[model samples]
Target: MEALFLPQIQQRNGCSPVQPAFPTKVYNGHSQETIHLHPFMIGPVTDTKVSLTISNGPKTLQLEVDLHDTVDQLKKRIMQERKFGGSESISLLYENRELKSSETLGQQNVKNQATLFIVHKCNGG
Candidate 1:
């Protein structure tokens, strides 16, 4: 039928697939599987709260961080707790994920009580 061939031709022509006016979701794999995600938040600063969780480590701490704080500040806080040196490399994780150095908690959409994991980065050459 024309309808069947039209989609193929459109694909060959590099045309985007037709989308519904309203948002639609299609599962590529494990469509029937249901996932339950626990909610968390980031805190400490008064302004700009983020909802995230840090489950990267065995022990999890729930707190809020101010978006105004830079990645360096966060590292410093973690260092104070762990008592690491100034030159040591530290990284932050939001929702069990790594955060880009340039990104702030506010920019990344973090929320209250979001668990953030602070880890040290090891370099060997």
Candidate 2:
């Protein structure tokens, strides 16, 4: 009824859906005016550590890692478990995205109990 159309009306009025109440700074509106912004540090996010499952065909491996660990670090850990001689031959896939080596677990948006696909990248013959 009215509830259904209310959201549309809010959107038309430019109301943001995902807005957090953060403090705003004042603007002097001058090129010469130097504005320094202090880094706003929020509280630590819960569950800094996460357990990820890597699915490789019939076999699956699970490992616990810190959110700050880079993808290359995860690759090394997997290398220890599997006989993949080199990590270069293998690739990690998450939701159709090929994970980069330098990206951290948090940067890649990896969550707790998340499953990643371990696949072999076919090279040009």
Instruction: Provide the lDDT at 57 for model 1.
Output: 57
Candidate 2 local lDDT, 1-125, one digit each (tens): 11111122123233344233444343434443323423355898587799999988877888999999999899889988864445557788988898888999899898899998888767895
Quote each prediction's TM-score: 0.45, 0.59
Cα error, candidate 2, residue 105 (Å): 0.8
Query: Top model by TM-score, which number?
Result: 2
lDDT of 1: 0.56
Off by over 4 Å in 2: 1-44, 83-88
* Residue runs of model 1 more than 4 Å from their true location after superposition: 1-56, 60-64, 83-87
Q: Pick the lDDT winner.
A: 2
Residue 67 lDDT in model 2?
Answer: 90
User: Cα lDDT of model 2 overall?
Assistant: 0.73
The superposed Cα distance between candidate 2 and the true structure at residue 57, in angstroms, equals 1.0
Cα lDDT, model 2, residue 86: 58
Deviation (Å) of 53 in candidate 1: 7.3
